[model samples]
Target chain A: MKPITKLTENEKKSALRIFWGQLRKVNRNVPEQDKIKFLKRIPFFELLKKHQLDEVARVVYEREYRDGEYIFEIDQPGAALFIIQSGEISVEIPTPKGEATQLAVISKNAFFGELALLDESPRSASARAIVPTKVLALFRKDLDKLNSTNPDITANIYKSLATIIGNRLKATNELIERKIKAVA
Target chain B: MSGSERSRKTRRIVVYSMTSIFFSILIAGIVYGLQPMILPFIIGAFLAYLFKPLANSFRGPAITKYIRAGALLFFVGSITYWGTTFIKASLPNEREKLQLKVRLQYRLNERYLSLMNLADGGKGNFIYKTLGQEFDELKKRVIDYVKMSDDERKRFLILQKEISDSDHENKKYYEYYLANLKNQKVDIEKLKSLAGSAIVAIEKPAGDDIGNLANIMRALSHWIILPLAFIFILLDKGQIFHFFLRLIPNRYFELAYTVAEKVDDALGKYIRGTMLECLLVGLTLFIGLFISGVELKMAIIIGMVGGLTNAIPFVGTFIACIMGVFYSLIAENVHSFLPFINENNLMIAVLAVVVIAHLLDNAIYQPLVVGSAVNIHPLVVILSVFGGSLMFGFAGMIFAIPTIVIIKVVTETLFAGLKDYRII
Candidate 1:
């Protein structure tokens, strides 16, 4: 019981099979229904009714990225918000000394580039896949189209966006103050 | 890395490239085989994309999306049905139409030859004016060199050679006319031959009775496939795009998706805006002509021609003007809304209608519907239209701009995206 062993090829294959099995189960559901449920879980869309979630799902685009592929680059004009469907993403920014800093590691069920939907601003940080990643992209124009059709869902998403931005602002302020204190 | 691993990767690359090549060849072969039946799908896809916003505008809690599509189909179907019935009731019978088609083709051929002769006449006003006695004779006799008796034509040619300019001394056209005038009368002869074969395709407006029922259904079936394709695309719920996206390898997935989105956005706006503007302009002309008491038949034809040509900016306006004045000049029952207007005055009225319609189009319709999306260099427009006409006839000419727009957007986006992704 106390002996340790390296994982064998057979065991690795079985683990991969199980992972794929779970993914297949996720995929086996009618795509529309699955997307509706998935969209409903997002904090931005959490307040949306089932039908409203269904409407939002219509314009959602699915994109997959290879490991190390950059989802977006710093200073690039952002056109869409990308929600991680399966794998991890890393958010990085350049420092004053020209070194990169990892701001956060975003995993499944999290979203990045949300600020793009609000305005045509360039991105502040770069995002790259940490692994083979599948993401659902909701484009800004699509969101505006949804706004015309379902103002309630668009309003809820925007409210969530506002809250998220507000929280980030407060955290950033605290971080700056702490840095100043440490310097003093 | 092991040699085996490197070998295996090389093999994979070869396999992928070979498979891609094979599939491309197969698809091309299939499309070539389906040439006759491809129009419907093309038309369907275009209409589907053009009408998508209208369908999108109708979504509500109570209404499912398909219901909205259905409502749009119903609306369009009803209008088409009414239009066809009106047209059928007013259209001339088969024999009358055939005669009219031949006459129109001949008249057009004569007019074209006249224009060509004027251009070639090269400031020889005396040579041009003596060929006719009346204004009508002026047009008819412009090509009179073609109709002259052999002896008279020979004399006419000799006289022309005597009076010809120094520029003509080097030219072989008059020399040919003088040397072997009758047998080598090629250009006008070729024009007549063309007028024979290219006469409006009314050869079998009412096909043989034996081919009626099943043949009619078969003809309708292909067109029906287009609308069905259109409907399925609208109701596809974005599955067509998803299907394509799914096929893209993970490495190129994001790049491909973004490029496709860009192409779709730009092309869709340009096409939809242009189409809506053309439809409105055509409708205005149709209404204007109808109220002005132009013959129903001529009015309908001119309306359609105006709509078709409206894709070309400056050229389209002048063409529409020429068509309106020409039709009014020839139409027997031409009257006008104004009491003082007669058949001759109707030409001016028609010209007024065309100018006003285009003015309104530029001021209101174009700005309101087309906007800046439809902008292209005039030279580019002319070249593309000519290229399209050379390649695929009338349909290609009509579709050239949209097709170019699609290719331009797709290639530009894909190249830019690939560079950004370091894929190529």
Candidate 2:
């Protein structure tokens, strides 16, 4: 009985060590502080209660795709807004000339699927993973439903969205202007 | 008529008969003037159709059937509570704002009249006064042109009569009338076109305005009726369904039941899914703003309105944005808790904040909410909504996309029986 008890203690120690090691491995790619900073940039989640934010963070998935993998196709309806978590994704738009041009390369922290959220518009452009890429997506339908039930959180999100749109328009115009000038 | 001609005539007669039946039913209802009370009930029934799933969810062993029923009741009660409270609370501020806006117009008008007087050879007017006067005169002149052009028909008719009658009197009068009439006619035509465009523009915004408010009320009403009706229906759903089933001719019993089931599913998915989507959006928005430390009541108000407004496809964005701005303005005015900044600076700050929030919503927020469920192509959705609004006024505009979605779903479902192809 004494020998069995000792063996059990040893086994427990080994199991604890293994668990710790696995946790370390999982967390090695992203530190807690960095995760907070990353989440800060996502405007929608900024106002989530500490507990709710934690719930989001826990479920937040990080997915990687190989270069040239289709992230989403134009006109393919999908749920979830993808935030470029790492690497780059190229946005391709078909010109009136009937050729696809790289309209933009969305980098880390950039997002897509907004037009879908406001209304169900088929995607205007196709997104291709330009490199090994990762994305964090939030489902609009789920989020909006939550908002109706919880007015306080909804209000915060509205403020965040208003500001984000204005800033993006400004930045996009600036980028386009620069591109035009360079070509000229 | 020939057999072919008779068939064509029969088809035309059938089509006209159906249309007239539909029109007459509505006209008859209106003739008796039962619309006001009936309208709300009809809307409520449609809503009950939409949120059938949510009502269904509040049933069965997964949740204690009693608890589920209570939950549904609670849902209805809460919606009523929040809706009335929000509207009641907001109405005063809204009225005050309107009053203030009117007063501001009146003040501007008074200043403008004085300035006009100064412009017309009124001496002893200072340089500042003259500048003010000039600005006022400019506005008056523009307004006069606008008002005059709006009534161009009467003006032109009178001018035409005068031109014909007076052409023989003074030669100068004839010459002047001819020139004035020619110029005025051209101006009048241009103004008419402008007015036509303006009418179109005004009609659009006005429809949206009514639709937006109606959407809020409608959404809130659904939250009430869906749960309430569902609970009662579930409690006696068997009886209700059986009674209808028994009423049906035995030959078409199964077909009728199946059609009812399909309608239930369509209404259920569309309404519940939409409601869920709106709620989620509102919550996410609220959480984001609170964490960001923005303290505007407008955010909450807008979020609520946005969730409600979001039911209208293509046009929802504009409605949501306008509501956001309006709420923000009210929030800024009513909340004195925040320290006062310069008024212009405060406006700029609010504007900046609003712009950023809208971007996040459009870019990141909206897609996450309704993207997966709404399969209609954006271009198609836009066109359908525009067409619907053109045809049926506000209600049509609001229901356009959803109706299209359901139609597409039904068409696909019906076709799927033929070949199992995905319609969406």
Instruction: Write candidate 2's Cα lDDT for B1-424 as tens digits.
Output: 5798679879978997898799889889775774334434444455555544465555332464456557755676688789889878866453244333333333334344444454344653565455765665676564344322234433433333444454554233323323333523446455334433322213465579798999888666645544445456544434465455555432233234434545555655556666666675555544443333335455576557656655554344455456544333323223323445332233344444445555655666556655455366768877887898899776667677668877876665444322321122
* Segments in model 1 whose C-alpha atoms lie over 4 Å from true places: A1-31, A64-66, A94-100, B1-15, B78-91, B94-139, B142-208, B211-214, B249-255, B295-297, B331-335, B411-424
Position B358, candidate 1: lDDT: 89
TM-score of each: 0.72, 0.38
> Which CAPRI level is candidate 2?
incorrect
| Candidate 2 per-residue lDDT over residues A30-149, each given as its tens digit | 544455567777766677654345434543334566667776666554444677889999999877898779988889888876655455456778888989887765545545654644
Q: How many times do residue backbones clash in model 1?
A: 0
- Docking quality band of candidate 1, CAPRI definitions: incorrect
Please give, for residues B1-424, the per-residue lDDT of candidate 1 as tens digits.
Answer: 6798689879989999999999999999999987767887887777778788888887654676668777777776787788789777767764344333333434444344454454445442554466534644655453343334443333434344445476543243344343332323446554333333422334665656668887878878778877787788777767788788777775565567668777887888788787788888887888888778787667777777787678787676787788787676445545666676675467777888888888989899888876767356768878898899899997688688988887778878888777766666
Instruction: Give the worst 10-residue stretch by lDDT in candidate 2 chain B.
Output: B415-424
- Model 2 chain A: weakest 10-residue lDDT segment is A54-63
